[model samples]
Target: MTAITNKGSGPIIQEIAAVIVENKAYLSEIDGKIGDGDHGVNMAKGFGRASDRISAEDTLTDAMQTLSDVLMAEIGGSMGPLYGMMFSDMADHLEDTDQIDAAVFGAMLRAGLEGVQEIGSASVGDKTLLDTFVPALEAYDSALAGGADFAAALDAMKAAAATGRDSTIDMVAKIGRSARLGERSRGVLDAGATSCCMILTGFADGIKTRLT
Candidate 1:
């Protein structure tokens, strides 16, 4: 009911990992309606392992790399590679920054999206995670361009993500197994986009306490 607040990525990542753990069963229940039903379990296991690997001495890249490694090795199903690619690409782009500003952070998200594009070949409106991710990243960029502060930009990004997630309910799935359902997919929200929004929104909410 309240706004998502965030600070740095470290504690937030840990919180995200925790969220995955807490919601694993619920996520699977949603996925069962339209997907393989293993998405929730895979995501939770991946993030939980990554959390144990993160540390205060670690950088964002380090945290992301740890996430990538865990997901790539341990996570199963299509969601593994897709989520892993995003975090890995984000880490690759962020190697140069110790602390990211709003613009820089937005660009990092762009890099992550590009990774997803490279792997999934899906774009916005295709009813994939990109539907939520691309819009959220773009919203972050737009808000920063409009002279909004970090918190404001993050707020816009989170809002756009929620909207994008909701939009999927009206769209016919254009890729993956759900696409096979044709018009039936129109009324059901995309599990991938919903989960992606949850991750991003969780970061925004958790960072409020950690960022200075």
Candidate 2:
């Protein structure tokens, strides 16, 4: 299959909101194990507000920007600003494009990663969202380098995201509130990583459905 259109796809963004909102309970549950247990609540509130403002006529970039704006402005957690920058950076990379191929997708991913890194000190194996996002991007690049189609590359990304999320279960928290737990944090999954997997997988699946 060819690449998906770069024109804003409102439904895709809506689907992302839906996925986050639907999984609110799960996200908060995980966070309760290592954090303030408000990850899902804040995420649902931010995404829900964005969904309400975004119309079907909005472009994918438009929808992402709206979400970023809300997350950055209204939410009050590390995730709020982190995810706000991520979506904002992703939208920045796609704003002028009309088509998104595998390479374009990779660039967008890299931009989002950089955006998050700019504001956060977490790194790979820190039991943070980077655990999921970094490997997912790497897997996507690897799949494309191996001549895989966009759809196949997305599949590889999703698989790698899940693996990365799971890997966090055994990782000691190296940042954030969970770091206080020290060795105790190793038994449960990182809420940020878990939510990142959901977001990445949801995004890939949503875009795949729009592929030509």
Clashing pairs in 1: 5-208, 6-207, 6-208, 7-207, 7-208, 7-211
- The digit string of per-residue lDDT tens for model 1 on 90-203 reads 888978575666666777788888888898877789888998998898898888889887878889999999999999989888899888888877887788898899888986
Q: What's the TM for model 1?
A: 0.91
| Candidate 2 global lDDT | 0.92
TM-score of each: 0.91, 0.98
For residues 1-212, write the lDDT of model 2, one tens digit per residue: 77877675766878889999998998999999889899999999999899999998778888889999999999969999999999999999998788888898899999999999999999898899999999999999999999999999999999999999999999999999999989999899999998899889988998898899
The clash number for model 2 is 3
lDDT of 2 at 43: 91
Model 1 misplaced stretches (Cα beyond 4 Å) = 1-9
